[model samples]
Target: MDVPLPLVPAKILTAPTTITQFPDYPKTLILEQCKTIKDLNQIHAHLIKTRLIHNPRVAENLLESAAILIPNLPMDYPISIFEKLEEPNSACYNLMIRAFTLKQSPNEAILLFNEMCGRSVRPDEFTFPCILKACSRLHALMEGEQIHALIMKYGLGSKGFGSNGFVLNALIGMYASCGEVEVARHLFDGMSERSVGTWNSIFSGYIRSGCWEEVVGFFREMLEMEVGFDEVTLVCVLTACGRLNEIELGEWIHEYVVAKGLKGNPTLVTSLVGMYAKCGRVDTARRLFDEMPRRDVVAWTTMISGYSQANRHREALELFHEMQKTNIVPNEVTMVSILSSCAVLGALETGKWVHSYVMKKRMKLTVTLGTSLMDLYLKCGSVGNAIEVFRKMPSKNVFSWTVLIQGLANNGQGKRAIQFFNSMVEKKITPNNVTFTGVLCACSHAGLVDEGRGFFVSMTREFGIEPEIEQYGCMVDILGRAGLIEEAYQFINNMPIQPNAVIWRTLLASCRVHKKVEIAEESLKNVVKLEPMHSGDYILLSDIYASVGRLEDALRLRNQMKERVIKETPGCSVIEMNGIIHEFFSEDNIHPDLVEVYNATENMMEKIKLAGYVPNTTGARLDAEEDDKESSMSHHSEKLAIAFGLIRTSPGTTIRITKNLRVCMDCHNATKIISNVFNREIVVRDRNRFHHFKDGSCSCNDYW
Candidate 1:
């Protein structure tokens, strides 16, 4: 039998005493009055001097206050106190463990628990909870499993050892934090009495792991069990809804929130905003945002990001400006959304302002912010600035490399883009699917067919990246752009994955370039099957028919389009002049100086014809005389936009135009002649590719 220690005398416990010539004070009163480290130290000296240091009650009180309640006291002080004790009790160990857990030094708590175990001190229910909490905090799965075995060995998991809801809840949390959600769920399912905290733990785990469907399923079960949820539970469910885009369920949850009068909760309201925004209801999200009594940085960021994702870039920028007017500061996320909007709008001036703001604020150049800057500069036609940003970035991820390469390819520097890809490889950075897409695109645009084929083979064989549909589409584009129409068709037929409409459309576009009527019809057949309502495919097929002198077939197709009410998307071109985008459609007369633009276009046509330009009337579909065809081609939207750009912009300043449709052959020929006659460089970005016309020659070399 273990020997029991003698109890301390009543005089030692209750009498007034002094240590080291200090004033006499009762030890209990001193311990109770101890609030700061100074008082604890004075009481500690008194205990040591009075020979009451071994008193269990006195030791417990000192350890509890110093380890937990006393602020600004070093943890080492309480740890030293515990270490000096001859035989510390479970309560003493529990106090220190809980202290370390709260202090975020969970490994220390584990060490203390290990020391407690080594000393053969049996842990009670409270001891297990604190140590298990430490395990959860550290995500120490193996140590937690060992502690779990100990709990079972001691019967502390059952009522025999007084293990209650707190212990079980900690157990669930520990497993969940270790990423063992299934095991946590097993424990949860076996529990006869589950607390709200238990459900929250499991739900949060599923959310953290991105098991969105399971989150919904468990939430449903939680409701069936009638477990009352708090703000945390609803927030998690709403997040899941946003991830899955379950708009209806999100609305129902909103109704529930309203029914429970929880609409006033800012956190839940933020979740609702994010959910509605992600589910394609920005108006609803904005309504909730307006209703909120207070808005924080996160709420503003959410709304801004939602608008950016919805392509409402103007609104996103407006909200960002509004956020700056308030006391709330813009974070990196806010800046990123702003830059994305600028990229989409090709707003170089606005993007430059944002970049200056970032420098003035001395914000850290993180990868995400740096990538956004690169994209903004690239889309705004400033390749030099984009390259400078890429080089200055302290870190570059795969996405950074991919963006630089794609930007180069898109700007018609395909050969330089391939060189960059080689540089990326020499740096030992692994290329992902997007990186390969950029590489293949570079090869395709530069007419490096053999090199493109080699990379496509190496992607799957060497890099172990299974070719996605995007890769297959790139290959088709490669073959099609190279005039290997038969090979492109063969590749599409042999594809393991089903070809999407984009792939068929790529083949169809190439068919039009080569005037391969049979292949164009076959590609159109597949495209129409996949996307029946797509007007572009139908228009392309009709164009192909009209090009081959089959007027009846072309007219039939056009009539069918009219009967189905499939309106062709009218061709429009946008030209940015003085930071304002000017949009023009075919035969558009909307500009204030429309008459001036038309006169300039007529004069340019005359000048180009003097340079031996002849209109390619085959590009026109009207069954009329050559004069009518030539007249129809003259008023094309891109030509009108070019004329407007030439008139508005200064002489010799490169005019840039963006078109919704591919540039027709007549427009292409006329643009080359105009570039030579006017001594100006004209850059046109069509839906297909860029056409850089200078001195009677085009960058695409008549291939496009």
Candidate 2:
């Protein structure tokens, strides 16, 4: 069945001539009545054709109708039609200002106001609001103040749209954004007709400047005044709570939202999750996430970012995957969380997949995304790939260069890392504190003592970037590796900022290297005091005692850990092949090819022992009967990983192993001997530095 078109309204279909017959004519008309500008021009032609151009009411209606469509119709045509009218009325002027305001042509509207006033076609109640709106749109405070003066002079301040609360609120918002908050407050206070929006504008002003306490105070005032809370108010309040970490306040807002029946609003829900997570209440965030009836990109993104911030990388990865399974398109923020999770986990294959996903989705891979990808690659022990990504980037920023330099340092290419830093400087780009920290750290890892000193001075003198705590830590690492334990300690004493745990630990490690017993005791105590919860503190302290032959003190420290009931985090190694990660632990013997792994490990041990290798127990707790800890060090994870590699691969293959802890001196020594005896190269990447083992030598010159 065919549907018939509906008849148009007769009022819309009829003409202005009916007004005279009806005797109750509208004083003004809208341009939409003509249906087309051609029809409108024809009406004007008929005006002149019928000699009704002198009819005052008809001329007023025609000009007003043309001005009504000024913004919507061609601007030039509206101006032309308006010029043809013998005497355009104030109604036409009002429509023109409204039209220009809608078109975002505030300057034209202001000029039109001047023209109207010149002709003594005085503005009425509607004129002031449009003028104020124009001033606000241009952010012209001076002009806005002039209009405000005019408003007061015409008594429009109390009479018309000037007294309208929303218009007043717009003025307040403009003034606040222009850094005239006091003026805004004055206007707000003087309002005889203030709306709730007036208060919201002030509240948002505080939020923009990170003034959470003021936001809270204003919100309280709003509550006390019984001004109804809206969604905008809730979002702002939640944002303030998230920044301040006032968990109790945030929770109260949550309950308020629920009571107000706004629980399921997506923006409110997302903000609540963020607020809870930012306050370190991940459980509450999870509960809200679980209860959300519908999840948008913002909700998923908030959960993913929350997990990332809380260091729950596994959950972040899981949620990202879930988002994909549900067909919710991930935005740039979502990708950042997923990339960060991969970086922390060193999930290279998955990161590579994400890069592919970026390409498939036609994402630009902007500098931020590219830099994050490089960091992920570096964390995954793929500096070559990071460098490649950096080189291919369309635009590079300081952060991008810093990540590359740090990645190189992380992967043990100290010289190359320094080269990258030098290139960054030569590019006329200034290096930030993070970039210098990475470069200096590279020099430390390679035992480039002179280079470290040079860069440290250059950082302050040339770049004008003062050495921060991390930079100080790197210098200590350098000097300590050069057997300058006292110098490192003196450097710490002279530091501008207080030395942190890394500084104390770096000095302690050097003491172990140089067998500096006395300084080691003091450094160890300071480290434990600074970071008692850090397992590395206890472990490093124990190792220094063992090196100094203080067996009793070593045992006492271990017993103190026992008293505290602290369990050591065991070291583990992982490698990805064809997409799956194979995890190996020290002394692990559970591989399906366990027999082969054990036999290969024994043979390698015998070969290295023949090369004058001894299990150097520098890292053992001295209190443990010497042989027991020596045996334990022999079963370190890197060794087990290399042995498994030898059993599975052919001879002469370069073995690579990454472990979760600092490689003890015994493992370091053993790897060097094994690399020499087997006539092969090996790379051992540990928590602190990388060891390139070849021909009974290491890249660190046996200092690290």
Candidate 3:
């Protein structure tokens, strides 16, 4: 076949001496200059015509460059050339083995290695590393052990045959990558002289297996022995530090990197950012990220994720917008972080836009991304959207199922959540502690006291899952919400673990609801000792005292709160419209449309009052007059948000609101009336659970 030659300089093609006149190794120098497969084909044909294809250096170089070094070439080209050789040498075998490994064909590499062994070709030091790397990729521990035996049989171990550390380094790496970290450690300790690569292999092993402590200890030993380290070493240690939250050691490493003048390296700098970010020093992480000369997707994603982890969700969303301005495309990880931020802020429109973007970009609905989207919808009071995402997911893991179950529980679909949990169990998915928390929460919100007790016992007896404090809290909530105040208090006292402030607060809140002032006082005593300055605890107790006609006690408690400088957490609510989040604070006048919103709120109060809505002012100040208390109840954050929603959205549109605190009974009752009077569905996600109000009813049925 006539091979078409590529466009090349005439002077080079017609040089005074053709490549044939050069020595075999020099001929390879010419082969290295071939830019494309066509260029290589022209030279390859010329070499075959000139009877120079037999030269090992020329053949191996052509195969290595074309098959491995060159970009975008197919594997068949080199494999065909390799087969045409009359007697392929070990060098050609090594080239193909490496090509297979690097090109994501580790299986082929292993098969070729076995063929080489079957052909009785002697493996060299270079050959072992290539094959060992292939073994590492495949996690072929059995094959790797066979290779190790070959190493010993051929006297290629560190103790025998002209020992170089390359073979042993590869061996250690293979063992580590196969999850035999201890064996890797054993090999590492037996080394008479260790290279930087040797240390890195063991560190990688420890990291891959999540043995973070071993990494830290080995790094300490490396420092003590005065072993010189490089960027690889620092990156490894920094990763371990990030996972372990070793901020002090991570800081020292940062200083060392600065002293070594390695601060210019982007990877090392990104590692520093991750280390600081994981340790809750997001500000420092941002500073370093800002100073980076170049920020890739990974660096940007790390910083955004750091913000989400620290609960600085708004900043994460802001940073994501900034990232979009640049050329770097936000990947799935970036989307997950941004969605998490949107979930916390209740930015439903923004979350929907992100979901649309994912669809437009044709990104796969991976479990992580899908779960995040479901969470965003669930938190934003979009239960239908969340359920849709959950159903469309191609695969479901324990976490994905748990997120769905928890989201359903939060959305007041507790019965459905429990059904989903049963389905998950029938499918043989083991539930973790978080799953049970969601399950118990479903029972608690649905007022399934009997079912809650059954599962709480079944968690340990059937699944061997220990009941964490969260599950215990759910039980208390379950009993308390059902008006079993005595049983709830007994359950708290008989708990295996010591009760925390949250437990006492749960009981206290229940007491206020059930009008048990005596138990409320006792619960307050325990809560005060555990969390003295907690505003909610004090507020709950005060409300209970006022409900039982102890106005003096309520007034005295309010005075104590003021004297102690403890203020109630102001209620905040968020609603999304036109892709932007609008926040309403109690009695807030800072919004751009404050006058309009307040007018709408007053109008809403009038309409609901005509529908027989009355403000329940049990928690109001005992010193305030009835009119002042009623007026105060009218401006609650959620009520204002609902009024704003009624104004901004067209009639009949569902109004969704997320509140920072539990919705007060007055707002809840008024909202139910407002929903019926206005003929609209209002979904309010309080701090605890969802309340869907429509036609003079709530999803919780006034139980919560």
Best by lDDT: 3
Give a tens-digit lDDT track for model 1, residues 238-273. 999998999888998999999999988889999999
Cα lDDT tens digits for candidate 3, 1-704: 99998878656645333344445454455456767766677777777887777787778777887788778898999998899887778989999999999999999999999889898888877888899899999889999999988888877444662255888888888898898998888888887889898899888767777788989999999899999878998899999999999999999999998998998999999999989999999999999999999999999999999999998887887898899899998899999999999999888888998999999999999999999999999988788899899999998899999998998888888999999999999999999999999999899888898999999999999999999898899999999999999999999999999999999899889998999988999999998999899898888888888888988899899999999999889999998888777899998989999999999999999988888987898766678899988888898999999999999999999999989999888888899999999999999988888898988899988878
Determine which window of 10 residues in candidate 2 has minimal summed lDDT. Answer: 18-27
**Native-structure RMSD, model 2:** 9.9
- Candidate 3, residue 679: the lDDT equals 98
lDDT: which is higher, 1 or 3? 3
Best by TM-score: 3
Report, for every candidate in turn, its global Cα lDDT versus the true structure. 0.85, 0.77, 0.89
List, residue by residue over 624-679, the lDDT tens digit for candidate 2.
57778666676777777788777665789766666788887788889888888887
Between the candidate structures 2 and 3, which one is better when assessed by lDDT?
3
Among all windows of 10 consecutive residues in model 1, the one with the lowest summed lDDT is 16-25
lDDT of 1: 0.85
Best-to-worst lDDT order:
3, 1, 2
Models 1 onward score TM values of 0.75, 0.70, 0.85
Error of 2 at 426 (Å): 3.9
Candidate 3: segments with Cα more than 4 A from true spot: 1-67, 70-164, 170-180
TM-score of 2: 0.70
